[model samples]
Target: MKKKRHLKKEAKIFLIGLGLLIFIIIVILIIPKKEKVLMPLFVGLKKEDAIEFCKLNNCKVDISYEYNIDFEKDEIIKQNKEKNSELKDNEKIEIVISKGINYQVYSDNNVNELGRIPVMMYHGIIDKKSEETSYTGGNVDKDGYQRTYEAFINDLEFYYKSGYRMIRLADYINGKIDCELGKSPIVLTFDDGLSNSIKVTGLDEKGNIIIDPHSAVGILESFKKKYPDFKVTATFFLNGGLFNQKEYNDKIIDWMIKNGYDIGNHTYSHADLTTTTEEETIKEVGRMYKLLKSKTNKFVNIVALPYGTPYKSTHANFKHVLSGTYEGESYQTDCTLRVGWESDYSPFSESFNPQFVKRIRAYDNDGNDFDITYNFKYLETRRYISDGNPNTVVVKNENVEKVTPTNLKIIGY
Candidate 1:
């Protein structure tokens, strides 16, 4: 009887052990295994940019290490998975970052390759006294402003008359065709959509705005009439916040697109993008891109810095990228192209250097005088005559003293 009882106990123990082993195996198979995914790291991205990247990749991040970057800090150096890999949900994605470099030293020696490109800027048309007197920085005198219109017509007329073809910015960048050097290869651009851009109060008999147009449509229409074949186009960098406001301008942006012109990105609120906080900077720059993208389904990669200056700390003597919220402030050191004025277009002088860019202000009726390059010369001569010092002396009862005029210049005649 005792031996039989011991055998029963052994059998029960064996069964219990077998049941536990089966349960363990089932548990192992039931739980799902996680899959691996790819996270790409660009050469010049920061921690914030990483986060944005993660957001794009579905909230999976596992940073691995950092590298020393002499030029840009917090930039991404590497990623865990190689490019074009399928990442599973919740899988860890490791990436490497870089320690930044001194921006000031870089700016002094650094140059932007794209800076070779020339850009022309302009304010409003000098139409009213209130508008003409409003010319502050880079003053486009009323007559000189008018000459820009005349120059446009003349440029189109010349192009049409001479059979010179016009091309867009992308055409030059993509190397569509080699330009004939010293043969007047140029890019025409304007900044800020002012009210004067649409008005046509001072146009010539050729239906050209002797004064600059106050509207976008007006400018395009005028250009179309004069040089339909040359395909004259201008880039209008917009302040997204100001588009619908009563004081802000641009009723013709849509018209320009429908009529075959391109639009580029300008910061959201026209803030000095260099000094703004990372979040705000991202919001500002990103917002404009988003707005334009949503409306036009177009991607805008070009940017024009407001105030045409870099952040105080950015040390941007020329143009450089700021730390973006999406991509830390990695200045585009490789770029060389920046936009500015080529010359003072008002008075005709042989002293103009096209390399040194000049901007214009188009406002009032007087701007009509500057409708053509020759018109520019005429206005300059007139300005010289009006501003020339007259040799008139005040007679005093006491001993007379020799006096010179405050605005005197050498008399030629």
Candidate 2:
């Protein structure tokens, strides 16, 4: 009986140990495993290459695009995170694609370097000289009008042949630099808001009097017909004094705006802003600005100062008073000034200094007057030579003995 009882106790202990072992095994098997982290998308990998890269790491793509890419076609422009960035397992790796290069075309008549555009200024086109002094400024050369038109047409033809595209100032300034304009861009600007502007006249194939708006409009239309892809735009600066007369300003302003032309401020009275008092100048400028804003309901931001006043050669005359990071320089510098003379000598006739530079006088077509390119700098010298008398300066060149024309105007058609 004692031997049998000892054997039963040993069996009970062995069973208890077995149960404990079983419980530990259950605990180990039932516990959840921790999740693994993921890595960031690889940089400089194409979509196909990135696919292979992600596959290697058990990842998937989220998005792909062409426009968002900053690098070459099929080349990676950007990635979501650093190459070593920790990511969750099965994370979607987003990527961007590239279309490589962009080539835009321009059809404007005048284009400069790096998409800097040239503005062509023109005036007065009439079949017959009008008696209306307002329309026919006597200073406008008689034959010169025809010459101006011919030159303009020739210039336009050159642009069209050269594959340039035209764009308006309004469109050009408000958006990203148009690559098209960069290639062969040009702007045709006609100041003084004449009626027979580039707008009014179309083309003169039939040559039937060629009325004002019709005439200018015809020319542009004709050009467009020849070059369907070419874009032609012009800015017309108007003298607001005409607005005072109901028969003139209101009708003309309405017509210009209706025809998709931009009107800029030319001052109310066309006064020379430089010589005029500050107060008078403001009044003149403000009046026109207000009138146009009221008439067209558009902000007149562009002001071609009557006669392009306050010429500066080194820097544009108007500097921004507010300062920023550009140049890391003082804000009070004379950067606002227009680019001054490059050579320090007058670009105008030699006698004229910086002050008289760009002072292109209106032509003197009257019988008593003669027209010559008079540089204000050279004006004093010429006058001294002419004994303080109003006479043409006799210019003698090596090729030609003498070329003298009194009261000459600069040919800037």
Best by TM-score: 2
**Cα lDDT of all candidates, in order?**
0.44, 0.45
- lDDT tens readout by residue for model 1, 167-284: 4443333323223311222345455544455443443575433333534445556767765555666655666743343422233444456555656566678777557765666676
Q: Over 4 Å off in model 1, which ranges?
A: 1-118, 126-165, 177-183, 195-216, 242-252, 311-339, 343-413
How much does each candidate deviate from the true structure in C-alpha RMSD? 22.7, 16.5
Model 1 has an lDDT value of 0.44
For candidate 2, lDDT tens digit of each residue in 202-313?
Answer: 3257532233433444566567677766655566666764423344455555655665566776667776655666556556656666667667764335555555654433
TM-scores of the candidates in the order shown: 0.41, 0.47
Worst 10 residues of 1 by lDDT: 385-394
